[model samples]
Target: RIERLEEEKKTISDDIKDVFAEAKGTGFDTKAMRSIIRLRKKDQAERQEEESILDLYKAALGMV
Candidate 1:
């Protein structure tokens, strides 16, 4: 069962690589795109956490 799962995972990974290669052929840098995606997700999460903290602070001060 585990071996089958591993093979499936590898197949999926290869498919992803092929897709990225196709995108690269269209003049896109997959690495840069991936980096940008990672950074945007991280930034969004950080912004959300910051906003949550700000909301808590405001509520503590009876402002909201």
Candidate 2:
């Protein structure tokens, strides 16, 4: 059972890689797409907190 599940997991991971490749071929920014996917998984409050901290760090580094 565990081996079968692991194989399925590997297949899903490969499919995800293929999707990202296709997006890249279509002229999409895969890195930014990945970041958007990650942010979408978070709750609004969590995203807001993270954005606020990022803004603060950028300001400290004079990148703001």
TM-score for all models, in order of appearance: 0.58, 0.94
After superposing candidate 1, which stretches have Cα over 4 Å from the reference? 40-43, 47-64
Give one digit per residue, the lDDT tens place, for model 1 in 24-55.
99999999988767667777778789779999
Which pairs clash inside model 2? none
* Model 2 TM-score, 2 decimals: 0.94
Supply candidate 2's per-residue lDDT for 27: 100
The local distance difference test score of model 1 is 0.89
lDDT of 2 by residue, 1-64 (tens): 9999999999999999999999999999999999999999999999999999999999999998
Worst 10 residues of 1 by lDDT: 35-44
